[model samples]
Target: MRFVPLVLAALLLIAGQTAAARPPSAVFLNVVAHQDDDLLFLTPDLSQTLKASVTVYVTSGEGSHPESMTPEDYAEMRQAGERNAYATMAGVANRWDRVALRTGTGTTAELATLRARPSVKLVFLRLHDWSDLHGLWNGEVASGGTVLPTGSPARVEDTYTRDKLTKTLTWLMDHFRPTVIRTQNPAPLSGFYAPDPDNPDHTAVARFTNLAAESYEGKAQVRNYRGYDDAQLPTGLDPALRAERTKAFRAYADVDTNVATLFDDTASYLGWRQTMLNRWPSGVSWTDGADEAYAVLGDEVKRWRRNVFGEWGKPVGLGGSGFAPAVTVARQADGRLRLFSLNRNTFDVVTAVQDRFGDYSGWTSLGNPNGPGGDQTGLPAAGTDAQGRLWFFVRNGGGGVSARQQNADGTFGDWQDMHGWGVQDGLSVVSAGGRLQVFATQCSARLYVTATCSIARLVQGESGFEWDTSVVPGAAATAPTAVAGTDGKAHVYFRATGTAAVLMAVDGVVTDLGNPGGPGEVAATATGEVYARNAAHGISARGASGWRAVGGHTEASPAVVGRGVVSIGVDGRLTQLVH
Candidate 1:
């Protein structure tokens, strides 16, 4: 690690103490080329993780699309616009304090600290635009943000090199040590090396940010969002969310723009020119068109470290193989972790096993449920029965739930159909009350459908698993998460389709717990406490006092181990939380 100067360290420590009495569960650093990149392309995600975030603009918002205003006025207006938009999402007044920070190379940057959430910050580097840096290739490899004098207002201070830019970003990482990093997508190399479909600044800034992350030795979960083309695609937000987004964008445009903006004009500008794109990097797949990434939990073969409380083992490994982005893990009574994943390219079901000592036996393929050339979709779920046998549930190629079990002797059983349709992956099975309960989300209008994709429940008795095909209230969308709480009642949690509120259904009664804004999984300790990952990617548990934001950032659905909850983090590592 790079050494921190005594003065700088003291300042950082003081700032940390004053920012929040308790450290933020996780910090997110968002680096972009100009203003509004995050607001434009990274929605719900940016809003979801704004609790402790920093948005860094590499170039001043000036120099692009010149109008009657002076360069300085345009720049200040853009910054003010961002402040208004961010303040709306953050639920605070538009107030911030400015601080001056210097990179290791002595290059200065402007840091704006939120008045309400001091931990949340904004940094501006004021680099040149894409046009000035275009065609200045160093041996067919073009680089931006490395040098000055090509354009930008900051040119008088110094010219940068790729190495210097990397070093500067490294300085930011050293100071913030973000748990998550968001940047624009870097266009991948193609056979013909086609021109980038996004803004050159977006691509360049992303490349520099990625390289800086690579040079930094510390761990940080990173994701890339689509750039300019995002606005041209379908609006990722629902009507309600789209309206909320319009208000935010309107606030941005009204901030010092002084132009009378009609509601229709603002809405049009947002929908037609600044909407969020639903695509992400392949490893980080989007969920139902939303931007949060997911991984299979409890996959076998990854190493798991014990939690800080030594209550459960931490997960280790990069999760399951293949291009599929989702995975689900189940903990067996024997203290083993069974991971189930889908092969997006091939639709094969993959399984891996992890032993008590944290050793993985590698991944094993179970072949496709529909035989060769089968097309499968959605995520798979796993559970264990009272007999200690593992059960894997998947949305079979035929659009119905299928199941197979591991015999007591550890042998595999033939796949069996769990008939009743309306299945689209996102399966959750739990052994409760001496019976195995299977839950899934069903399309309302399709085969075995309802009005919308509603929650469906099936119970396995001595006669075998049977579906009620009845819709669970408040579970009008996505998958259902079931856990037997400490109260001795089985609870099912689901996001009410349109509202995104997490509704807890127990014994036919459902309570709205507000929107978690992300997919959730259920885990329960032996003591009966229920836990799930909150919208901020932190662990939260339902106790007598209600839901509390526990710490940790995870990308996988949670599984229970003893009294602790464990899930995969964005770094493809395991994170555990125990009371």
Candidate 2:
């Protein structure tokens, strides 16, 4: 998998610029409960959020075993590796922060930060880490590996006390104010709905996370982004079969539906082979991410490479990361809620509420909506309007940007052409009042992340074909973005000759925010204060307090939800601002 250095560098340069442009909308407090959770569960999202802020709340290491490493040692190494990795990708390691909280496995941890920024802190409550090697099942058919259930989440034996668990989690909720929280399920064959009470650590994580969300009283969104209860270990699939699943798996490991960033986000993501999660046998440690130790080299009898990498990876039956293929949760200022993701092109909204999610195993047809076979490429931004109306906007290849509104009743509105005459490669939509605000970027040919969302729009003639307008100070002409701010104003920001151009409707009169950077993005928080991310920095401006973060790395537009708070999931992490 030798790639051209130049191409990768070029892509990075472009991607870097893009990151400074679009930036994500959601302010995520990664409710991760296990090790390598982001990779195995939300690879697609982690792929894109690499540029944003993500705080991992880990209970245990690879396997909740003292043999793996001491709690103190494990915490240091894990945090160090994580920080180094994040800095390598985001390029703004200094802006990030990390802190460890004290508590039992049953409790949660809360740290400090503003409404915006990666305000998440890790709570290494001394909970049992579910061993990829040991669980409900015993080793060898004769080993006594059976599914067990223990009642009460606080009863994880001598682990964290119930009181300790509650306090930790309470502190976490009160401090971060996370709207979207994620965790694992009780069992493998089951999902969030299933109940696996035996493992106190597993059960505690779920119970504790739920408790936090509940404490917020639906004021935040919650979802189990992981739960591959099955066996994360490789099936030792006779070589040939293993390769097949890996490719399909990579397709998903590539993109983030929410962030719209790159796929295969990890530095080693590209060269990843058959890193098997579980090895039916133990003999291996997934703690150090040691691929060689747990790998199979065709066994001489069968020369096949199953890239089984459990160490520092996900667990058995799970994505070797204790994560999911694709799970989208929509949270907002009001509270926590579930989000529906239409499997790629299948507009059919695959409702995998429990065990049925993505289970093509017993599955039939999903009636993909982006046309029969479906366009796995991408879908337009799906947002709800004031009237409780569900909206669907697509950057139809030839049909320009088409939009359709779906009501809670499952019905749809007429598909209208918002970007008339010409077509765009990207589509973003936000509702302000009764009107729908959409933003798009027209690619010269195909689409790329560099398709700036922050760029200001200088509408070409009438067809809307050319996007030669930008907000970047001194940057030449570039395409601009079309977005509806929270204050009921529409804005378009872009880059020009490295500079930036901001065009927005201020009381019917278009006003410029300022010159922060190029092909950048702008999001309004509470009172219509706009925050833009461009170049390798960010800019914020409101009433009197002008724009700041002059240095930002944005690749997606801001998704502002709360009154004074705005969340921005970038590169591969979640960062935000609270005024």
lDDT agreement with native, every candidate: 0.58, 0.34
lDDT (0-100) at residue 30 of candidate 1?
88
Candidate 2, after superposition: displacement of residue 306 in Å?
A: 40
Question: In candidate 1, what are the lDDT values of residues 26-55, reduced to their tens digit?
Answer: 677888887777776665567766778888
RMSD (Cα, Å) for all candidates, in order, is 10.5, 21.4
Q: What is the lDDT of residue 69 in candidate 1?
A: 66
Supply the TM-score for candidate 1. Answer: 0.54
Q: Where does model 2 exceed 4 Å of error?
A: 1-378, 383-387, 411-421, 430-433, 437-498, 506-509, 537-545, 550-557, 561-573
Per-residue error for 164 in candidate 2, Å, reads 48
lDDT of 2 at 176: 43
For 1-579, candidate 2 gives per-residue lDDT tens digits of 111111111111011010122324443455555544444443333333432334544354434323544444443334333333333334333223322233322222322221223432233333435632132122212111111111111112233444444444655554444434555432222111213412334434554554444444223334443233212211212133234333434332332121113234322232122122110111101111111111111010001111434112221221111121122222222322223233321333332111324111221222333456433212334555555555555544343455555545444555554443233323444455455455444332111111122222322233422333332222212323444555565544433322344445433344655554423334444345555543333434444655555333333344343333222232223233433
Query: For model 1, where is the 10-residue window of minimal lDDT?
Result: 283-292
